[model samples]
Target: MENSDVVIGVIFLSQTIFGFLGNSFLVYHYLMLYFVGCKLKFTDWILQHLIVANFLTLLCKGIPHTVSAFGLKDFLDDIGCKLIFYLHRIGRGVSISSTCFLSVFQAITISPKSSRWTQLKVKSPSYIASCVYMSWVLSFIVNIAFPMYMTARWYNRNITRLRVFEFCSSVQHDKTSDIVNAVFISIPDVLLVVLMLWSSGYMVCILYRHKQRMKHIHRSNFSFKSSAEFRATKIILLLVSTFVFFYTISCILQINMSLTHNPNSLWVNMASIVAACFPAVSPFLVISRSLCSACAGNRIS
Candidate 1:
């Protein structure tokens, strides 16, 4: 088999394995969340929205491509390609938006009395539903143009040179397409990164303040609350950090791949794998925190 075959094979195996594992666990956890009588609190609602989005991401995009990589029937004809890519892009756009919402929600949840987000903190499940519904609608509206802009094009058999997979490719980026794509992608990415950065920075600042307060109180210079909360915050921080890192890497690789050419390039697929890893790990990390043994113990007591 050629290196292309080998590369695609490994890529398929990894996608299948990760897709199965991630989506299966996400489904299980979602079911458990529903069945365990855990009221769909605001944060829980956010998590559910995220889980649903990630599941869609994996299903609409990951699984079909995985099957195709394994030599499954090319069921995604022109129309199928249009719909699949459109829906997949919508779901992924939602994923990014939902994540931004999560970070903002968390920051608001932890806001001090002086903060302006305090008012939103008083809202309950109803507001949660409204926000989540808005998120879905916003995501859909933002990405609806994807299908409009993308069309299936068969490479002319005569053209000896092309880029990427030619069974379907966007026509050269026009002014309208360039504007739409940039607007859609940039807004969510910018909002998410900004929220993530602000929340993470605020957490560190608050932790610093608390540590100083502890030292002033105990005079011991060692603080248990600071240590413990940092541990919890660190988990969430790590999840966000890893995602940002991998996302940056994937984006850079995509830019490079577009500018350069190598059908045999391993980095291109590696970047896809990296981008896929975030959704794979995000849910379990959320589950790990939400369903902590301490919370379970508190319930028992």
Candidate 2:
């Protein structure tokens, strides 16, 4: 009933609604493209998975936070908490994996034919589905620890070792089990982040070299700016940078929370907002890029 709670609730509600609509629009647009038999780039498939994962993440992370912020409680049972937490983890995992894969795929796509990655570029599109499938499988299998530990939040409040959420609580595990689970979770995340950074750096280097070459060949700067490949690569770079920025902030907040023996709700809510930033903002970026591409095509024709 507090004004602060109302404001928080409205913020989360707005983010969830806008994110869902934007993602839905992209999904619909892609489906229409498929039905009309339009020629689609292989990267489009990776984006489809990303969009879906974003949608899932928004719903799972947003609705519960929104509801709790409004001071509603006890709506979720044990099963509900377990399912929501499990799905949210899976969605987050898939989102990270998909972004990493997309970055690597785009880097390969734009590599020169003479480069050592030429073989990978040629064979990569065929493996897109397999990679997506594996991401989903790995996400599901790795987060099984979540469901085992999650329970509906209890009002009795007798437990000291539980990690309490708005509607769910995680029972603390033994130190050994916790270490093992953390290792399994952290390793994949670290690998994906490293791959993303490497691929992004590679793309930046290629773009720089291309720009220098273009400077010698063309008097007008517009030639490089007007390129479709340039625009596409720019969009991917924007997405990667946005994701990394928000993900880093979220991780920092999480680490701060873990260092505190009893962190408050504000830190938790702030972390959730930071985590949701990329999902809420990324759809608009892609939509703008798509519109720009269409306009460029028309201009060329």
Per-residue lDDT over 69-136 for candidate 1, one digit per residue giving the tens place of the 0 to 100 score: 55553455667656776776766766766666666665566566787867777773456567668867
Worst 10 residues of 2 by lDDT: 292-301
Best-fitting candidate, measured by TM-score?
2
The Cα error of candidate 1 at residue 189, in Å, is: 2.7
Which residue runs does candidate 1 get wrong by more than 4 Å?
71-75, 124-129, 151-163, 175-180, 215-232, 257-268, 287-301
Deviation (Å) of 177 in candidate 1: 4.4
lDDT at 57, model 1: 66
With a 3 Å backbone cut-off (N, CA, C), the pairs that clash in candidate 2 are none
Q: lDDT by residue for model 2 over 91-117, one digit each (tens)? A: 899999898988898898888889999
Show model 2 residue runs off by greater than 4 Å.
155-157, 219-226, 291-301
Model 2, position 248: C-alpha lDDT score: 93
